[model samples]
Target: MSALPASRDDASPLSARAGLRVALPIVVLIAAIVAWDLVVRLNQIPPYVLPGPLLVASTLIQDWPVLFGSLLTTLWTTLEGFVAAAVGGIALALLFNQSRLLEYSLFPYAVVLQVTPVIAIAPLLLIYLPQETAVIVCAWIVAFFPVLSNTTLGLNSVDRNLTGLFRLYGASRWQTLLRLKLPAALPYILGGLRIAGGLSLIGAVVAEIAAGSAGAGSGLAYRIAESGYRLNIPRMFAALLLLSTAGIVIYLLLALLSHLLLRRWHESALGKDN
Candidate 1:
């Protein structure tokens, strides 16, 4: 038999193509920012209504301490909530995967929790718990469902052939889960993580908006509200820009982590041939 040619996985053409793909978005972002700055400058818009990028940048530079402190608080809260959600969601997903009866009984409750509005629940949580705890709980509620749903799907998606192989090997349930199902589910869990990362930040901000900030625990959302009330438009825009940047950073970080983890073996982590 004749041998076929090798596949081009690491050639210059492939690397250059990937570089171009990455460069395209960055170029678009720079163009958009430039266009936005030009439009604001040409229109001579009032800072109170629509601050130019320069004004927002100046405000951010001037209020670095206050804004950075608030950003840290928000980031901390989101990280706490997201971590808790990731752990709890995976645990619950495993439990649900163990039995169809349990899944039927518990899955609806999870859906109900997910459907309940965080804004509506935040007030009640605040009344019942400490402010920080309330905020964390609210954030967890908002972020948990995606992880739960995605992880559950991953766990259940094991191939029947694999399941039979594990059974033939006399694998215990736990052994099968640890060695087979969990590995298979990693991409799905990471997918949920990417989504939950953004949701966690949003949840923290929304809870802060609904419940208001307590001393020593205020976040960027509180700063935004404070700026709006005081008519500090430039400062508000600065806070908003920080929040947007943080969200984007969180998403990109999770995506990169997912790609790194999957790149060794997963098809989804690799590019397709044209």
Candidate 2:
């Protein structure tokens, strides 16, 4: 008799690969920053024109109070907009899924809103709404479509056989949706949330930039604009770096949340080659 080799369930190889992926990007980022610093120093570029990374870092520290305050304001607006988008998008998608007539009638308007450029609409919104409200609306508008479309697709993506079995059990619409449809649709919905997180930040920034520092416009975007006007290039770079870092953090957090929620059952979130 011959014995077959046994397979193990260890994921250490994939874990190492994941570790490499994270470490490699960090290394590249450090290298790039170093290169940037060297170039600015070698060329003796004026600080007003282009500041080195060290200057930017120092400026970030010196301007921490103002930057942190603005960051908090921007984060609040982002949170508001993201909450609105998530709620409205999911509610509307659910409503549309329940009724074809409503879906056909209102989906086009949603599409129109999605297609219209937020920058073009920001001025008009400013004319009508309060500055903060307009900024929030802009963020909401940009973040809304992905959630709606993805949820709609997910709700419709249920297996027909499973749906039939649910029906065979005489399951009510709500029961089927809550138990079968939503659970199946979770991955798509999480993906939409991840996309929406970044879009919401961008939308807030665009609105803030367009609005300018008129009143108490305290946001990283406004700071960037103000710094640009004053020719404080290092501060501008610092604010920009903060904005980029915020966006990346939002995306990573959302991705981690999605991975945690879906890792057990969903193929997409399962470890590579698992």
Candidate 3:
């Protein structure tokens, strides 16, 4: 026989790896669901106490309208907070990079905000600000520090030789910042944003839970709290599942964006095979 053509899998190890990567998670998830269902059946567990995955799925479908509305509310708040954190953090970081005195004066306050638990701050915020605003502010406070810290690090990490070269070529401060510092910092900034995306959701949830206690809001977290009070465990699980899915989607989207932006040049975005 003449030489055979290479099989698709033989030709593309990366493709095989990618397929395995996706398939493994799906297999694991299916196995987990099957095990959960079996445990519920074998033990005669009540739905209220531990709803099976199937029951939760049905419950999610049944309550889709209400749950989805709450999800949208929570997502909107997350977006607002993430946007605020991105803009404010980057702007502040730029300012800090330019002026050591400004950084010294303001950086401590940023740290204080980051260290203070948003759960503790939520109640006070709810008291002083409108419910929606308080929730968004909490999200912003939780997310802001990572972006500020990361961008600052990236800016400072620009090579000293490159900095000197830019100065040697008579680059203005703005030119150095725009051309050299910002490009060097892009990876760090994107990494910070990936973290911030999930954190913004968490902060919104915490705030929503706080607001829910006062019978105020309609975010998914509030729905979770409401379901708990009613002992509607299936609905609670459904709401939680939605929240988890939302967070995962947000993270994946940011990660994809970062990869798309940096893949041309950044080592972090490159595949191992590359």
Candidate 4:
């Protein structure tokens, strides 16, 4: 009877946990927005300098059509950049894992590239490539490093004992890697991807900002730049809000994906056991 009740208690849904998880952030956000509104009103801050929360919200609604289109454009660019980074990073990490010489020869260049700012490179990319191509490349540059480094770390962190056990059982290299190492690395890889998702959006925004100044862009960042030039402060705020929301959505989606894929076995994903 005690066991039954204990099991029943454990079996209770995680919905309560989930609700608390969501509600706390919503509450804090509401409080922050309210405070922001008060500050603007109390200080008599000019809209051109900093629009209040209500004005920003109103602008978002009023300017949704143009803002929405720009939002889609930016999102598409981010998705493309993210896909490219994921593929290139994972594939290169695999190659580096397989060969020490290759790793030594190429890894420093990767670090150097990462350290170099994408904004500095954007103008040159625009000159050499088309505007759209330059923007996508900028997005890829900033998003690539975290995935590459994380995946490489994961690939190298496999248990030595399990490796030796596999060798003792006469498993082939590929078999050992596929069966044991990759499984262990899945968590790290997913974590890298989550970081990459937000980074890809940031890259897209920065590149778009550079492109917007050059006068050939249509993304949300471009809209912001255009708005600034026109003194359309409300529209600028609306576009900025959309960009921020898109970034949050990207992070949440990646986090949800990581959780779904890891929940059954990984420690990070497993809630209090039911």
Candidate 5:
């Protein structure tokens, strides 16, 4: 009889664990897909109006070559823009960190660039610049601000006690920045990178939309627009799915990188079990 209550207690936690481990997520995912499929099928939605997952998958397989090629192009453009933003933004942040006068003088301009809608400026950029250059520039502009802003904040937010200690130790300005400030700011920098990665993808797509087709350098966004123009709804949805997947992958990658880099020392990186 005593063993019965003990077994029940043990079984309760195991049952809850099993639900969390397997049942809950599977149920939620199935429910979502079922609801989506039902809404599409039961509502008599035309494929053009809202292609079902099956139709989208069929489209993906059928147009694999075209869709994959466009995916590669968009990925390349996003990476290029993100790389440029990382280098330029970090440099600018460092410069601003070193000079309050310059920060005050130039920050408003950065804010203006950040606040200005890429859609508004993309057309002008396309008109004024070569096609490939315009797309890259527009993407760079869209992604640059987050890294700049986050890194600057991080650099400025070094612990006051640590700063005082470093100063007391006769650490020079450059030494303090390199040994203390930059390390302290890394988490913030990584956070900015996550934001910039998504923005880079958006910027590349938006720039392509504004620039339209110019020779063979078009990305996924161009394919999306072209597909829509030709009423290739399934293909459009397929391209959209690829874009969404890419964005998710990029975010996961950055999160993984952040965790790996910070896991040893940072509280944010610690797993809940720890």
Candidate 6:
């Protein structure tokens, strides 16, 4: 009887906390929107200066066709960059894992790429490369280091005992890498991919903004810049809303993929229920 009550009590609190986690953000968002509406109305803020949320929403609906097209362009660039980053980073990390000499020589350059701001690099890329290629390159630059570093760390972090056991069994280097290191490093690789997904989007946006000045692109970031020049405040906010939604969607999709892939074996995915 006591055990039954204790279980019920524990489960009830966990459920309530889970509900609160979901509800609280929604409540806060609604309250913030209300406050924004009231402030705008009371202050008589001109729509040109700061259009209310409702106007932004209406503008989004009104401009859906154009905004959607630009969004697609940006998404395409982000996708290209993300794929490139994932492939190159993982491949280089694998190479580094195999060769200490390569790791020593190339790791510093990877660090330099990461430390150097993509925004500064974008203008030069735009000058030398086509606008689309430049935008994708910028996204790749911003995203590549995270995957390389994380994967390198993961590969190097294999348990010494397990490694010794493999060696004891006379496992070939390829067999040990394929059977042991890759599986051990999966969580770290997923974490890096999650980070890279958002960063690729950001890199594309930055590059598009740099490209916008020359009237060269139709990406969402370019739309935002165009709206700014025209003082179409509602349109700017609407474009921003769409861009933010895209980013959130990208992050959620990657997180869901991570959870799905890791749920069966990984602690990080397994602990969610508790």
lDDT of 6 by residue, 116-234 (tens): 99999999999999888999999999999999999999998999999999999999999999999999999999999999999999999999999986947999999999999999999
Residue-level lDDT tens digits of model 4 in 16-83 = 55666799899999999999999999999999988998898899998888899999999999999999
* lDDT tens digits, residue span 21-81, model 2: 7998999999999999999999999999989999999999999999999999999999899
Off by over 4 Å in 1: 1-16, 213-217
Model 4, position 263, has a per-residue lDDT of: 89
Best by lDDT: 3
2 or 3, greater by TM-score: 3
Model 2 residue 234 lDDT score? 96
Query: Lowest summed lDDT over 10 consecutive residues: which window, candidate 2?
Result: 1-10
- Estimate, for each residue in 197-250, the C-alpha lDDT of model 5 and write its tens digit: 999999999998886755355588998988898888989989999999999999
TM-score of each: 0.90, 0.93, 0.95, 0.89, 0.88, 0.94
Poorest stretch of ten by lDDT in candidate 5: 1-10
Name the lDDT of candidate 3.
Answer: 0.95
Give Cα distance to truth, residue 158, candidate 5, Å: 1.0
In candidate 6, clashing pairs total: 0
lDDT by residue (tens digit), candidate 1, 222-257: 999888888999999999999999999999999999
What is the lDDT ranking, best to worst? 3, 6, 2, 1, 5, 4
Q: What residue runs in model 2 are displaced by over 4 Å at the alpha carbon?
A: 1-16
Over the full model, what C-alpha lDDT does candidate 2 score relative to the true structure?
0.92
- Model 4 ranges off by over 4 Å: 1-21, 272-274
User: Which wins on lDDT, candidate 3 or candidate 4?
Assistant: 3
Residue 160 miss distance in model 6 (angstroms): 1.1
Candidate 2 lands at a TM-score of: 0.93
What's the true lDDT of residue 260 in model 2? 93
